[model samples]
Structures are given as C-alpha cells and as structure tokens.
Target: MRIVVAPDSFGGTLSAREAAEAIAAGWRRAVPGDDVRIVPLADGGTGFAEVLHTALGGTVHTREVVGPLGDPVTGSWLEVDGTAYLECAAACGLHHVGRADRVPGAARSATSYGVGQLLADARSAGVRRIVVGLGGSATTDGGAGMLAALGLVPVDEDGLELPYGGAALATCARLDGDADLGGIEIVAASDVDNPLLGPHGAAAVFGPQKGADDAAVAELDAALGVFAGVLATFAGREVRDEAAAGAAGGLGAALLALGAGVVSGAGLVRELVGLDTELDAAAAGGGPAITGEGSFDWQSLRGKLITAVARGAADRGIPCVVLAGQVSVGRREAAAAGVDSAHGVADEFGLEASMADPAGTLAELAATVAPRWGR
Candidate 1:
C-alpha cells in the first residue's frame, strides 16, 4: 500500500517538513513496507519560501532591508518556476517585535522595503510572474513602503520624500510611479478579503493581534485611509474597496496600486505544489492523502488552503483527512468542504506534548485506523 503524508506547519510547534518527518517515522515503525511520500507544504503565509522551494525548486535570495521598526534586517525570498515568492514576515514579521515593543503606533513604522527589494530582484532578473505570498506582515503602512521601494515616490507637503511608515501617510500629498517593472507579473496571493479602510480593514481586524491598542488601530486605519485617497487620486480608482486590499497589512492595496490582482493564497500554493495532479495520482494509487494547517476555522471553508487541498482530494475520489493543531469548524461546514475527517491535534493533547513525542501519538492513531484499512 502507498500513502502520501502532506502536512503544513503547526505554527510555533513544528514546520511542515518536521511534521511530515515525524508522521513518516511513526508510519515506518507501524507498517515498515508501506510506500510513504513526505511533502512539506505551506499555504503561502509563514513557510512560503520553504514550500515554494520544495514545490518549484527555487533559489533563496537574501538582502538587508528595513524592518518594521526601520531597523536593518536580512530578509529573503525565492526565485523559481519563472516566478518569485515573497512574504514580508521573514524580515519584518510581528514575531520579530518584543512584547514590550508591541506598540502599534510604533510598529506602524515598519517598512515593507524588503518585499519591494524582492520584487526588484525578480524584475531585474527578467522574471515574468511573481507570486507574492501575502501573510504574517508586521508593517501596516498600507504597503506604501513597499510601493516606495518600487518607485512610487511619496512626497510630503513640501514635495520631499516622506519618511517610511503609515503615520507619514498623513503627509503624503503627491505620488509618482517610475519603478522599472519592465517585465513583472505580480500576483497578490492574499488570505483575507477585507477592504482597505473599514471595520474589516487591515488595522481594524488584524491590528490587535499584532499588538495594536484601540487608539493606535484607529490611528493606523486613518493613516491607511489617507494613503488610499492619495493613491486613488493618481490611479483614478478606489483602492480601499479592493476585495483583498486589507491583506498583508494593506500591502495588497499597495500592490493593487501597481496593477496586481488578488487570488486565493491557497490557490497559489496548490498550483505551485501540483496539488491537482498529486490528488489524481493518489487516487490511482489507492492511498489516503492528508493535508492541514495550524487552525481550521470558518475561513477554511472560504478560499483557504486546506479547502483547496480537500477539494483536490475529493476530485480524485480520495478520502482526505484534515489534521490540524486545532479545529473550530463544524461538521456540516467541513463536510461541505469535502473533508472526510477533521481531527484536531490540540483536542488530543497540547501542541508541545504532541509534537515533542509525535512518533508515539502518530503510531497510536495509525494503529487505531490500521485495521479498518487492513494496515
């Protein structure tokens, strides 16, 4: 019998690669001759570079760029499959900031200059399609810093270069586009559909998670609103209303200002990993396939990555089991998503205990299900 074990990152506990290895180890102990393939995957958020490199055979390019606090940090992205994948978090993620430094007003000074630097490298290399994995963002400057790096000049009232940060958007009076994006197909792979400036906007929704207080969130929201108005003034279009404008700290809107379109982040990951073909092969092999993420919530039923994975398995007539660190989704909802089983690792045990001794737990689960499938 053949089995494919594809798992995503368990957030702070285990990487997708590590999780796959642990599960494979358990299976090896249980059924020694079972054909098992390990594919470490990500949904275009935290482990985006690793997943793209695994799926597309890419090269990592690192550079020193501005962090969320304007500090110099080494950030990296990938260039492969005729495209580059960039996630702002590698260099300027919220995790980089200390709990004390979690001041939203101060964190607003975060700059996505590194993200632009990645795009610049892709463009300079004559790369055509660039899929930006938009997640785990720290800066909430409405992507102005990223755009500024890409040659969108933000001028102060006196037409001087406005300092990087959403707070400076209040002074953004003029905008000019002179970036040399000669041959770049930018795709904004976004996970959220929040508008640019509203209750569900970047600041209002995701700000608190990133350490923003009520007042600071409003301030950031207002600043992003200003950035949107200025950008719309030049683009002659409403940037705030864009479906994914709130993604990546409103960097989605920044990319939109540059003529990029938003697609499901999971869709991009699925295509990169050849999920459709993988599912077909899994069905033919008569083996069960599993894929999951850190959490399975209502969002998964949307265009989230796990749903796409489940959809691929369903299309191939394979029973796909979704094993996550935590599951808050309902049966009716998950059934509609075509997930045959929704198992929560958290429900079984704490993440640290479960992953620290993953082999035993995996073996137990496998043995329990082994008889049913004649393992």
Candidate 2:
C-alpha cells in the first residue's frame, strides 16, 4: 500500500515538516509493508518559506532585520531558480514577542520594517521574481514601516518622517517614492480576502487579536483611511476595497500598490509542491492521502490547506483522511467537506496532553486510525 502524509503546522506545537515525519513514522509502525510519503504544507503563513524550500530545492539566504518591536532579529528567504520566496511572519510574527511581553504599547508601536528589509534583500539578490507570503504578522502599520525600509518613507505635515506603527498613520501627509523595485515581479500569496477598509477591514477584524482595544481599533481604522487616501493619489485609482488588501495587517495592500499579483496561498503551494501529481499516482495504486492541521473546523473547510489537499485527493478518486489536534466538526460535516475520515488526537489524549507533545500524540493517533486506511 502507498500512503501520502501532508500536514500544516500545529500552531505552537509541531511544524508541518515535523508533523509529516511523525505521521509517516507512525503509519509505518502500524503497517510496515506500506509505503508512505511525507509532504508538508503551509498557507502563506509562518512556515511558508520552509515548506516551499522543502518541496522545491532552494538556496536560503539569512539576514538580520528589525523585529515587530524594533528589536534586531534574524530572517531568511529562499531563492529557487531565480525566484525569491519570502514569509512575512519570519520577521514580524507574534511568536517573536512573548505573550507576557505583548503590552498595548508594544502592539501600538510594532512595525513591519523587517519584512520590507527582507524584500529589499531579495531584490538585491537579483531574483527575477519575488513571492511574499503574507500571514502571521504582528503589526498593523498598513505596511508603512515596510515602505520606509524600502526607501519609500512617509512624511508628516511638518515634512519630518512619521513614526513607526499604525498610530502614526493618522498624521501621514504624503508618501516619498525614493525607492524603486526595478523590473522585478512581485506577487503576494495570502489566504485572506478582506478589503482594506470598513467594518470588515484589517483593523476592525484583526486588531483585537493583535492586542488592540476598542479605542485602539477605532483609531487604527481611521489612520488606515488616511493612509489609503494618500496611497490612492499615487496608485491613480482607489484600492481601499480591493480583496486581500487587509491581509497581514495591510501588507497585502502595500503589495497591491507595487502592482503585485495577489494569489491564493493554498493554490500556489499545491502547484509548487506537485500535490495533484502525487495524489494521482497514489490513486492509481489505490492508496489514500492523509492531511491535517492544528484544528479541523469551519475554517478548515473554507479554502485552507487541508481543504485544497482533500479536493485534490477527491479529484484523483482517492480517500482523504484527516488527523488533527482537535476536530470541531462531526463525521457528517467532515464528509460534506470532502474528508473521508477524521480523527482528533485531543479527543483521545485530552487537549492538554495532545498540545503538550503534538508530534508524538499525532503519531499515536495516526496508528490508531491506520486500520481504516490502505487495506
């Protein structure tokens, strides 16, 4: 029997690569004669660059850049066949700042300067194309900090450069376009589709999760409006309502201003990893494909990595089994979402224990569920 194991990162627990290895290891333990393939996946989030590097051979370049809170941090990007792959979370993710250290002031001052620094570095690498994975960002500066790092600084009424973070956007007068992207192609890969402004905008919806209070959310929204107005003047068109413009705290909006193509992260990753080809091969051999993430919920069914994997498996006439940390939906729901089988490690091991050692627990759960697959 041939089996494919593909999984996204389990939040704070295991990385996608680690999860795939653990699942493959356990599946083999249950059926030693069965062949298993490990394929890790990402949704243009924290592990985007790593998964792409693993799927396609690449040269990783590391650079020290500013963190979300203006601290020095090391970041990396991948170069594959003259194309650069960069993950925003590598520089501005919430993981860099501990929960205990995430004060309101820190949230208010966080910037995406490091992401901008990384883009510049990628451009300097002489890559013909750059794909930015916009997810897990910690700032809400509307990508102003990134622009600043790229030499496109925004100035206030007094002509002094504005401070870092979303708070400073309220006083932004105009953008200074001193930087040039040359002739490089820029693409933004993201899973979100929210516009840049209004009730469903970046600040109103994602601000609280990043530590903004009601007053702060309102302020950030207003500041983003001001920023949008200034940006519209330069873009020669209104971009405030464009889809995906709210992703990664408005980093997607910045990419739009640069005339970058916004694409679905799941779709891009699936093609890059050759998921469909693998699924077709597995189906021809009458094998099933296993996929999972931290949680299998409504969000998972809504065009996430697991959803794409399941669809690909279905198209190839292969059963898709899901092994998640927690399964919030029922068996019927899972089937309706194209998942043939669903199992939650938390259901068997309890939430605390499952989260404590997710890789090991996931391995154990895979073995328990192995009998139902690859007869």
Candidate 3:
C-alpha cells in the first residue's frame, strides 16, 4: 500500500515537516512494507515560507525587524526565481505575544511594521513578484503601521504621526508620504474572504483571538473604518468591502490599497506543493491519505491546509484520514468535509501525555490507526 502523509504544523509543538515525518515513521512501524510518502503543507500562516522553500528550493534570508509590540524580532523571507515568499506571521503573529502579554491593550497596539520592512527588503532585492502569506497576525491596526514603514505615515489633524496601534487610527486624519512599489506584483495569500469592515471584518472577527475585549473590538473596528476611508481616498477607489480585505488584521486591505491581488492561501499552497499530483499517484494503489493540524475543529472544515488536502485526496477517490493533536470536530462534519476518519492524540493518550510529547503521541496514534486503513 502507498500512503501519503501530509499535515500542517501542530501549533508551536511541531512543524509540518516534523509532523509528516513522525506520522510516516509510525505508519512504517505499523506496516513496514507500506510505502509512506511525506508532504507538508501550510495555508499562508506561520509555516508558509518554510514549506514553500522546501518545495521550491529557495534561498532563505533572515533579518531583525520590528515585532508586534514595537520590539525587535527575527524575521525571514524566501526568494526563488524572482519571487519573494513572505510569511506575515514571522513579523507580527500572535505567537510573538506571550500568553501573559495577550491583554486587550496589547491586542489593540500590535503592529505590522516589520511586514513592511520585509517587503522593503524584497523590493530592494529586485524581486519581480511578492507573495505575502497573511494570517496568524497579532495586529488590528488596519496595516497602518505597515504603511508607515513603507513611507506612508498616518497622521492626525495636528500633522503629528499617530502612535503605533489600531486605537490610534481613530485620530488619523490623512496619510502623509507615498508608498512606491515600483511595479512589483503583490499577492495576498489568505484563507478568509472577509471584508475589511463591519461584523465579519478584521477587528470584529479576529480581534478577540488576539485578546481584544468587546469594547476593544468595537474601537478597533471603528478605527479601521476611519483608516479604510483614508486608504480608499489614497487608492482612488474603494476596497473596504472587497473579499479578503480583512485578512491579517486588515493587512489585506492595505495590500489592496497597493493594488495587490487576493488568492486562496490553501489553493495556492496546494498547487505549489503539487498535492493533487501526489494524490493521483497515490490513487494508483489502495491506501488512505492522512492529514492533520494542531486541532481538528470547526476551522478544519473551512479552507485550511488539512481541508485542502482532504478534498484533493477525495477527488482522486482516496480515503482521507486525520491524525490531529486534538479532534473536536464531529464525525458527521468530518465526513462532510471529505474526512473518512479522524483520530486525536489527546483522546488516545490523554492531554498531559500528548502535550508533553506531541510528535510521539501523534506517531503512536498514527501507528494505532494504520492497521485499520493502511492494509
């Protein structure tokens, strides 16, 4: 039997590649004769540039840049064939903010300045195109900080630049300075298609995850509205209601203002990683295609990396199995999303053991499930 093992990063515990290798190792342990192929995936989030670098063979460049909370943090970008692949999470992800620091004030103040610095570096390298993976952000500033880093400073009525934070955008009167992209093609790779304003927008939907309270969410939303109005004026068009304009804490809106195109992050990653081709090859033999993430919850049913892999496997008449750290998704929901079976390491080995050894527990779970599906 030929088995395809593909999975996204299990939160911060293991990378996608590590998870894939662990699952493949365990599957081989269960059935030594089986051919296990590993393919890691990402959906424009934390592991975006790393996974793409693995598949595309790019030169990874690292540099110190401004972090989410106005401090310096290490960031990286991948360059290959005149294209730069950048992960927004590297600059301003929620992971940068410690659990203890994840308060409403911090959430309101997180910035994407480092993302602009990365873009500036890519442009300086003369890349013809840039693909920005936009998710896992710790910001809600409507990309005002990013724009500021790119020379487009947001200022108040007193002609003073506003402080770095979403709340300060409420006092923003207009933008000072110009952001010159020099004809580079910019792409916003994102999973969500939410607009930049209103209930389904950036602050309202994602602010709480970054630690914003109800009041902060409302404030950030109103502030983003103000920034969007100014951005529309600068862009000479309206992009506030555009699809995917809310991605990465309205970084998508900023990219839209820069005339960037939006594409599904999962779809792009799937095509880049050649997942369908691998699934077609795996379909020649009879075996299940396994995929997973940190937690198999309602989000998995959306267009996440696992869902993309499952759908690809399903299209090729291969059963899709999930071996996640924790599985909160219902079986019926899993089935509806092309998942044949879903197993959780936490459920099988208890949360304490799984948390202590995520890779080992996940591997054990995969080994336990292999006999039922691998043969």
Candidate 4:
C-alpha cells in the first residue's frame, strides 16, 4: 500500500519538512514494502518560506533586518521563477520575542518594519510579483511600521515621526510621504479573514496571543483605528474592514493600501506543493493521506494547513488521517472536516515524553497507526 505523509510544523518542536520525514520514516518502518511519500505544508506562518522553497526549488536569500523589538535579526526570503515569497513572521513573528518578555511593553512596541525592508529588497530584485505570507506576527500597529519602512511615515501633530509600536499610533495625526512599489503585483497570503478594526479585528482577536493584556488590547485597537483612518486618507480608500485586513497584525491592511490582493495561505501552499495532484494519484492506488500539525483543535478545522490537506484528500475520495502532538478536536468535528482518524502523541505517550521527543513520539504514533491504515 502507498501512504502519503504530509504535516505542518509540530508547533516549534519540528519543522514541516522534519515532521513529514519522521512520519514517512515511521510508516516505512511499520511496513517496509509499503511506499511512502512525504509532502510538507505551511499556512503562511513559521515555515512558509522554507516550505515554498522546498517545493519550488528557489534561491533563499538571507539578510540582517530589524526584528519585532527593534533588534537586528537574520531574515530570509525565497525567490522562485521571478516571484519573491516573503514570510512576515521572519521579520516580526511572535517567536522572535521571548515568552518572558512578551509583556505589555514588548507587545506594544513590536514593529513590522523588517517586513517592509524585505518587500523593498524583493522590489529591488525586479520581481514582477511578490507573495507575502502574513501570519504569526507580533505587532498590532495597523502596519504603520511597515508603511513607515516603505516611506509612508506616520507623523504626530507636530509633524514629527511617531515611535515604533501600536501604542505610538494613537498619537498619529497623519502620514507623510508615499509608498512606491514600482507597480509590482503584491499578494497577501493569509489564513484568517478578520478585518483591520473592530471586535473581530486584529487587536481584539490576536493581541492577547502576542502578550497583550485587556488594557493593551483596548489601547492597540483604538490606536489601530486611528492608524486606519490616516491610512484610508493616504490610500484614497478604506481597507480597514476588508477580509484578511487584520492578518499579521494589520500588515494585510498595509499591503491592501499598496494595492495588494489576498489569497488563502493554506490553499496557496497546497497548490504550490501540488497536493491535490498527489491526492489524485494516491486515490488511484487506494491509500490514506496523513496530515497533521502540533495541536489538532478547533483552529485546525478553520482553513489551516491540515484542513487544506484533508479537503484535498476528501475531494479525491481518499481517507485522511491525522497524527498530531495533541488532539482536542472532537471526532465528530474531525469527521465533518473530512478527517477519518486522529491520533495524538501526548495521548499515546505522556505529555512530558511527547514534548521531550516530538519527532520520536510522533514517529511512534505513526508506526502504531500504520498497520490499521496501511493495510
């Protein structure tokens, strides 16, 4: 039997590529004669650029850029087929900030300026199109820092530039200067469809995840509202309420202001990896496609990488299985989402053991599940 193993990163424990490889190894171990194929995926977050580069055979360019907290950090982008793929997380992702440091001060000061620098770099390369993977960011500045980096400086009443951070945007009276992208086609690859401001907007929904308290969330939201107003005037249109405008902490709004289009991050990754075609081929051979992430919860059902993979398998009439770090999603919900079976490393092995050896425990779980599914 042929088994297709595809998984997103196991939280921060393993990368998508590593998770796929481990699953494939365990499946092969369970049944050496069975053929196993590995396909890794991302949803425009942590592993976005690496996963795309692996599938597209691109050149990865690395540069030193400002991180979320105004520190210098190494960042990279993928250039493939004259299209540059930029992952926003590489510049201002929450991963860059330590958990202990994720207090209100850090949350209020995070900036997306590094992402704009990357966009500038891509534009300098003369790429006709640029796809920005927008998620896992740490800022709620309404992309003010990004716009600032791109020459749309946010200024106070005194016409002085505002300091970096969402809180600083509260004092923003207007924007000085304009962004010049040279007319390059920009695409914002995102998973969430939240708008830029409101109850379901960036700060209200994602601020806490980046370490904002109740007060910080309120402050950031109000500040983002001010930033959005100024940006609407600058762009001659309103993008604050557009779908995905809240992604990457209002980076989506900034991109929209620059005439960027939005696309499903998971869908784009699946297409770039040819996951549907692979599922079609696997279906012909009668095999179950396995996909997973760190935690299989309610969030996984809402257009995440695993959901995209399961949908692809379902379309091809193939069974889809999941082997995740933990499984909090109910079986009924899993079935509704086109997942046939779900296994958890933490359930099989204790949480301590699973967290200690994510790859090994995941491989063990895959090996255990293989005989039942691989048969």
Of 3 and 4, which scores higher on lDDT?
3
As a TM-score, model 2 comes out at 0.93
Model with the higher lDDT, candidate 1 or 3: 3
TM-score for candidate 1: 0.88
lDDT of 3 by residue, 1-375 (tens): 889898988888999999999999899999898889998988888899999999999898899999999999999999999999999999998889998888899988999999999999999999999999988899999889889999999999999999999999999999999888999999999867889999889999889989999999999999999999999999999999998899899999999999999888888988999888778778987867999988898866656777888888888888999999999999899999999999999999999999999889888898999999886
Q: List clashing residue pairs in candidate 3.
A: none
Pitting candidate 2 against candidate 4, the one with the higher lDDT is 4
The CA lDDT at 370 in model 1 is 36
lDDT of 4 at 115: 92
- Over the full model, what C-alpha lDDT does candidate 2 score relative to the true structure? 0.86
lDDT of 1 by residue, 32-136 (tens): 766777777766577878877877777888888777777777788888767778876776677667668877666567777767877786787777788887777
C-alpha TM-scores of all predictions = 0.88, 0.93, 0.96, 0.96
lDDT of each: 0.75, 0.86, 0.91, 0.89
RMSD, every candidate, angstroms? 2.8, 2.0, 1.5, 1.5
TM-score of candidate 3 relative to the true fold = 0.96
Q: Which digits, one per residue and each the tens of the lDDT, describe model 4 over residues 72-181? A: 98888999988999999999988889889888888899999999899888989999999999888988888888888889899999999999999999999998987888
| lDDT (Cα) of model 3 | 0.91
User: Would you list the clashing residue pairs of candidate 1?
Assistant: 68-110
Report the C-alpha displacement of residue 306, candidate 1, in angstroms.
0.4
Judge candidate 4 at residue 188 and give its lDDT.
92
- Which residue runs of candidate 2 sit more than 4 Å off their true CA positions? 329-336
Report how far off residue 64 is in candidate 2 (Å): 0.7
